[model samples]
Target: MTTSPNAPMTSPTRRDITAETGLPYVPPGTIPAPASAYDGLPRDTAVAGDRGWDRDSELSQMSKAVIATVFGLALLIAAFAVIGRLGGWAADYGTILVYLAFFLWMSIAGRVFWWGADTLIAEIRKKSNTGDCR
Candidate 1:
């Protein structure tokens, strides 16, 4: 049999391809299935629920955490300044520098803690909502 130049090819469409491959067929403007669909998957990071903090609430909490961190840093700086006025050579410059470094470490640690807690709680909430939490 001869094929016409204008004839549509017999090759399978994308839906057919996915069906044969056991993969999902994603339509345009639709979110694809998350990685958690395969095996014993990790939780999705995008979902937030009423059990913990919602997205906006999480952002607000993070903002507050950052503010508290900065406040703690400012207190350290003030303490160093007061120690400098007390005529301690170690506190005059070196202590301030060291405290600055320590403040950075503390801020980073706090951020990590807050982020981990938020993620954990959010995942728990998501699982609960989806009826996956046991």
Candidate 2:
């Protein structure tokens, strides 16, 4: 493992490091393989933060938004149906208004939900002291 002082240093491969140290070698600038069964588990449930937890949280939030939007649409339909039965301007133009309102509501609600999820994740990471904010 010794080199001449005048020799140029070259990047070492994983195999070279492994052979020299007799241990598992991880390449530079790469995450190492987990050392134990509990590695990479969620911080709340385990000793360290899960590297993919943010991705899972995002997917969960998207599914929730979809479900909420669907439920909102159903309720809007039911309300519009009841109002349209009253035989007023509602019956004539309420469909367009309802669609517009639904879109607006979805945008606002989705943004809020996403923001809240991000904030919660950030707070959890902060409290756990397991994530590098940078």
Candidate 3:
């Protein structure tokens, strides 16, 4: 019943599936099952093993921390800039300067910290011949 984008398309009928599988087609709605199958089950067994740090979490602790810090700094700087403008000493150049000084510094610091820490740790692990990343 599946076709590639360039393939000639044909509407799939139950006959098509039955022909492919050589078994009678039982439509999904016809299946009898409880509404909450495996309800209350833990998603996965609680197990720990050598799932390495180099390949585990979607984002490492350092990465999440760095992103959060940069985002927070950006928010704080923008808020302060707006407040400054509202306080009657508004200069476009001043706001820009504040942004450059604070946000730019924070962003650079975050990138540097994440990169430096990760590289340093990786290098250390490489020297020690302990990290199995390939």
Candidate 4:
């Protein structure tokens, strides 16, 4: 069988309104037929990053973050203690230096915590919303 090049293309459509998108529904196996390239096999898995849920990538990202945070906090604590001791060695500067160091440490640490919390919340929201309408 051969279709003339000038013949109009047509397919049977469904009656559904698709309440959400409000677009005319296309019957399954009709419009936009699947291609052999994207039949969801090993070939498709090669584009793993696009899928956004690979375990190894996520593990590496999380581990890097955890290690960096631990290292940073360790440095911060050591600096704080060293500065505190130096401040104590000076009689008149002790209270003032302690207060300044405390403020500085808390301010920077608090902002980092806030940003991490916000990112965590956003990631949680994104994870929870993975293609789920509700």
- Best TM-score goes to which candidate? 4
Candidate 2: tens digits of C-alpha lDDT, residues 35-116: 9766666555733553644544465544555565556556556555655354454467786776666567656656655555
Tens digits of per-residue lDDT for model 4, 4-86: 99999985345434665678776567877558644667642766446545665556433444554565566567666776465
lDDT of each model, Cα atoms only? Answer: 0.62, 0.62, 0.61, 0.61
Candidate 4: lDDT over CA atoms? 0.61
Query: Per-residue alpha-carbon lDDT of model 1 for 30-128, expressed as tens digits?
Result: 986566433453433443432533455456543554565566556556655665444454466687776676567556656655555565567668778
Off-target runs (Cα >4 Å) in candidate 3 are 1-35, 39-42, 45-57, 88-134
TM-score, ranked from best to worst: 4, 1, 2, 3
Instruction: Name the weakest run of 10 consecutive residues (lDDT summed) in model 3.
Output: 45-54
TM-score of predicted structure 1:
0.32
TM-score of 4: 0.34
Stretches of candidate 4 off by over 4 Å are: 1-92, 131-134
At residue 38, give the lDDT of candidate 2. Answer: 69
Off by over 4 Å in 2: 1-92, 130-134
